[model samples]
Target: MSFVPIICGKRDWDVEYAQSQEYNAIYCPNCHNYKVRPVKRREFITIWFIPVMPFFWGKQLVCPICNWRQDFKSDEQLKKVLREQDNIRAGKVGG
Candidate 1:
């Protein structure tokens, strides 16, 4: 699949990221239910000089047939956006 990056957190942008992927079930201890736990998948990548370049991609699984979900952004997409932004800022291309 083609990757695309998007911002997620509001005030949590003061950190760095690494290229990676993750998968697991989201178990809720408060509910004490197994099915209440859904699956989760994600990816992330970091850039050297920009906090805005941190890309995160993922999707939370609820049900297969239901199509209820939360999707995340990929690192490649983030890198691309940052690169494009940098290029534009540098006057390397047209607006």
Candidate 2:
């Protein structure tokens, strides 16, 4: 498989062009069930802090279909998603 490029600091190329893959998501927002997502050009850019010492930052995606929605980060989104289930442990952010 080809490598999916991930960057930090600044990117030279336009983000739109760099994203070779189309990320698709259909949310039954009413039912709270989201459809399987397509392969996204993923990256981890950080800007916040909230304990756990090692859990911040995430997947950044430009939604293909719902281009209307805000571009969401994978890390922040996942944190909000899996706030509970304490027993599990993981390395710090950027690990």
Candidate 3:
């Protein structure tokens, strides 16, 4: 039998936040639109293009249209945006 070399590398996966709005009121400086949403970026070790182990992770408010991103320093900061989004959805705040 011939031995095959294993390919291991890091990969990033962008995951949408569960409570995020479909189209938030936050404006994207790059896209000039209100198409921002909370997103989680997960970095993983991949073998043959399949994720195996997690390496690193981060959170951001991103625009899917133009790929504009704003990184979050802490969960509280991220939650603040999410709360604003909820207020907008509930008509408590102007969108």
Candidate 4:
């Protein structure tokens, strides 16, 4: 009988922001559009097309239109941007 090798490898899993209101305040320089939003990226070990374990995790602001990504140093830094966006939407000047 011929042996069938199992397919195993690393894979990227992305979780987009789930808020009811889409965050579109961040501008994308690459696409020149307001489609930048936060996303959670996880690198996982996959076996037989199934994710086994996550080895790496990160948060980034990404533009879906142009595939632009900006990594955040910390959760606080990311939160600061979200708060600024909220302020901007509220018409608060000089956030």
Candidate 5:
């Protein structure tokens, strides 16, 4: 009889991301590119590389070049960030 050992453990962050069109014109401060993309993030638990349960989820603005993530709990919050950033870009506020 031969037995093969299988590694089994829970892994975090099974994220699902989708870019939003609302902030497509926004530029990333770190990379100096107009690539500030809004993404939906979902964290899940995995067993043997299979997602079995979801633990956390949220929306964020991600800079692809810098890999910076800014989290928001609601649509209103995201809109607030967009407005704030736009103001900064317009020289109406100090970033």
Candidate 6:
């Protein structure tokens, strides 16, 4: 007789707002790729490739090009990021 143990867990992210042109054009600090996107962070505990529990849901700005993530501590922080993107689109600042 033999027994095997398997452990699995993963973090998931969903695109909450991806309509900002400036956000898409922004360059990633890690990869220097112009593919930064807005995403909401979600973590889950999985058993046998199935999500069993979800936790730590929050807003974030991510660079899909290099898998970089900037988590938001509060709603104000998320709003600030959005405002920054808008400012970039408006040419008020460099993206």
Against the true structure, what is each candidate's TM-score? 0.25, 0.21, 0.59, 0.65, 0.69, 0.62
Give the Cα error of residue 2 in candidate 3, in Å: 5.5
Candidate 5 C-alpha lDDT tens digits along 1-95 = 99986655565442434445676766677788887777777776776678778776777778878887677788788788788877887899753
Using lDDT as the measure, name the better of candidate 3 and candidate 5: 3
For model 4, state the Cα shift of residue 17 in Å: 3.5
* Clashing residue pairs for model 5: none
Models sorted by lDDT, best on top: 4, 3, 6, 5, 1, 2
Q: Which sections of candidate 6 miss by over 4 Å?
A: 1-4, 16-18, 73-76, 82-95
Residue lDDT tens for model 3, 1-95: 99999998889889877563443567666878777877788889999999999977888888889988888877688767767756865789653
Expressed as tens digits, the lDDT of each residue in 1-95 for candidate 1 is 89776544422221223423222223223443323213344333433433443344443334334344443356465445446645765789875
Task: List model 2 lDDT by residue over 1-89, tens digit each.
Answer: 89965433421111332222222233422334444232323333333321222232323333444432333455445344333212222
What is candidate 4's lDDT per residue for 12-34, written digit by digit as tens?
87898554464555767688877
lDDT of 6 by residue, 9-87 (tens): 7857585664755445655678876677777677888887788888778777787667888876765776677677568
Predicted structure 2, TM vs. truth: 0.21
| Strongest candidate by lDDT | 4
Off by over 4 Å in 3: 1-10, 18-23, 79-95
Q: What TM-score quantifies how close candidate 1 is to the native fold?
A: 0.25
| TM-score attained by model 5 | 0.69
Error of 2 at 77 (Å): 3.0
Top-scoring candidate (TM-score): 5
What is the clash count of model 6? 0
